[model samples]
Target: MKRETNRRSFVKLAATAGLCTLASPAVLAGSHPEQLAENEETNKIPKKSWYPLGVFKNPVLESVFLFYVGSTWQRLSDVGECFDTASRIDEANDYSWSDQWIKTGNRLKVLGDACLKEHHEFTAGESYLRSSTYYRAALHHYPDPANKIVKELSLKVVKNYKMALKLMSIPFEAVSIPYMKTELPGYFFPAKLKSNKKAPVIILHAGRDSWAEDYLWVAQQAVKRGYHCLLFDGPGQGKVIRIQGIPFRPDWENVITPVLDFLKHTKKEVDMNKTVLMGFSMGGFLAPRAVTVEKRIKLCVANPGVLNWTASIYNGLNQIDPQLLPLFQAGNYDLFDQKIEEYMRTSSYVKWGITDELWKYGVHKPSELIKKYQEYNIEAVAKNIGCRMMVIDGTGEEFSVGEAKRLYDALTCPKDYVLFTEEDTGYLHCQPGALAIAYTRIFNWVDKYIDVI
Candidate 1:
């Protein structure tokens, strides 16, 4: 994968940037010398009642059911059935949620196939979509990215997704946007009712681990509100990383610029002047970062603003192993990687987090990966944003504790901050359990800022 070559080049670049504190023994030994307990106490974030069950119980499974409620995919009773089935399986400590989801997904897939054979297209399509969601869910938090099971499940996710696409009532077009040397894959859903009129476009991109398919719930919302939705997989994300081996870049503006150019030149039905860019999860960071330089973006929405990727990594690393910082500063990347891998082996959360980051960032060593996060910060560039911005965060968001406020404060442009609270059951990362409320607030904000109706 040329990972070693990339690592060498990155380290050389870091050295040129005068970030060689890792090479200093004194820095390695005493840098950021604070008690681990004190650090934890100072930065402690309360765990959500839904997360442990949602992530550990089913591993990326609940969001599908939660977001798709009242939609064609499945009913609440069906979701309850799946949840009940999941509850029967012992939560395997070895991070076997992948296997659990696959088992349940296969059951739904079989039912869908049977329905298809019986000429029940609507039932078959809906079940297939649900099964596809479950298949994709299986890959989340799966420790071994290179496992045969992962590949098998990934292929099924795409296959079943295509099956659902074929049967969906809404028009969906598979698109490939020209980028640097390669192409970015995506799906374009044009506004159904506004077929004869030019409509505002909402461009959405997923974060580090999510794919374009995962945004179906939100995209449907945009479509319902008479906005054309374009959901694409950018660099270091989805097919771009999985198939093309492109690592994530800090300058997302370059990626988005091409997309904007494509939309302007090709899709004449899209109202470019009223275009909005929306990002979820890590996209919360990537979207806003792109808008800082891309002036064509009239409105930007980041669901939980990510002020600095480095801060999040540093906080997580502090919780994992404060001593590892010294190794990072000392440039002993091999030892650092070994220690971090050892620590990750003890927890599923750490395992998934590190493995996903390593894969997405295309770095071999833990220190190199952490260092790469420094480039993703937007503090220095926030003032460049000239459009209306919306920053969303859950009051209980763990990873990006105070990032929403920090990002909002830094923005010199017109901006709005929304904090979903526990009483609304929207106070979790990206407001997973409250998609309706989130979308209502999001589109209402969008309508207020732009002509989306």
Candidate 2:
């Protein structure tokens, strides 16, 4: 009720101005020509832009942010429309909003992070469940009771989802403050086939611009093999904090502590000691950060660990148009008014070195965060980690393959590095298409070092 009231009030304030309805591909085509392939139409919207849902909500800003967030249905909708109109835009350019939706998403992520921080304390708390369910329902338009997707969820799946949601409902208490209070969303899956002992638990972490739901297939795969899995949207990772507004922290031990404690306290069918932490892309950075402090975490695995966060951002930003840099440095949109192409090209969020999102989410720049990163330095702590480890890297990945090797070499415990070439596995970043291979390699490596039984 509070959220709906807030959204309605905010929507009125944000979208009531001189706003435009739809953005023609013709406008975007001229500026985004470089994005087109040689065979593609220079003036047409890429096939990727035509959503089955008819651009869901706001067509303007969602169109832009979609490129950044990988074009999900929600951003293409009305919520996104709100973002396009909320910002203080340049009147000269005929745009009403500034960077509004991105900020909204970031703020929601922050509030969610705060809520989860409380939820972490109340792992089994009733209020937390009520609040979280409300949060999700609010986001999904409280899907109609007769919706087929809602109907199709079997009672068993519904029960499990509710069970997990119940676990997530627990409210945070002040007394639990001393312990780590990590912010990550999790998915729980029970093993399918029976095993000799409790099922192995895989803690899933995804990369930047990735959602927790993105790894459902992975958890499903693990479940089929009698492995229990938990996937959480950690700070800066998934919906709980990424799109909602939670900031990244260097001490990931805090981010992971809640889930680890939850697993240890409940879940009889799971062998907490058999737990493995797996991360992809930026998660490569996150999982390693937590593994060092949480000794109970049994395995540290990454799909191409991001060795240098700052460097990566720098590279991404440098690849964009050079002319847009002035608008970003000045934090002015005069150039945007002159030309939409100029503004987006130079947008700090669209640039690499521009750490605006971190700031927007209440985090320090990469340079500062990395200082905290050094405290949990995976390479330095790899020697201290007593658990088995696995590192997977795609040869064609734009990020460093060397970091994975460095981690593999530095790990004092038993470790394995599995490299998949384009020829062998069509994996880039998190072994995208080769998840089966990735899982097999990880389990095989872990089995060799520590018995899952």
**lDDT (C-alpha, whole model) for all candidates:** 0.70, 0.47
lDDT score of model 1?
0.70
What is candidate 1's lDDT per residue for 1-453, written digit by digit as tens? Answer: 453433332322222121100111111122212333445677754332433334223223333334323233423125564565456545555455566667777888898899999988878877778788777666654667766666667678778777877766657888899999989988899886544578889999977666788778667778888889999999987767666678899899999999999999989899898899998878888999998888999999998788886786565555445676778778888898887777555545555556667777878777788789888899998889988889998764655668889999999988999988755767666665566787889989998879532
Best by lDDT: 1
What's the TM-score of each model vs. the native?
0.82, 0.53
Error at 285, model 2, angstroms: 2.0
Instruction: Quote the positional error of residue 450 for candidate 2 in Å.
Output: 5.0
Scored by TM-score, the top model is 1
> What's every prediction's RMSD, in angstroms?
9.1, 13.7
lDDT of 2 by residue, 1-453 (tens): 653443332222111111111122322233223344532756555433232123333333333333223212212123343334333333223212222332343444344446557665333333322222223322221112223332222222223334444455411111121133433445576775454568678888765544454555566566666577787666644354423355556567777777778777766777877788887766776777777678887777877755444443333333333333344445454552343333324422222112323332354442343233334345446566666667776554444435677766777776667786544442345544345566677666755654643
Off by over 4 Å in 2: 1-184, 192-197, 242-244, 306-356, 359-361, 364-376, 443-453
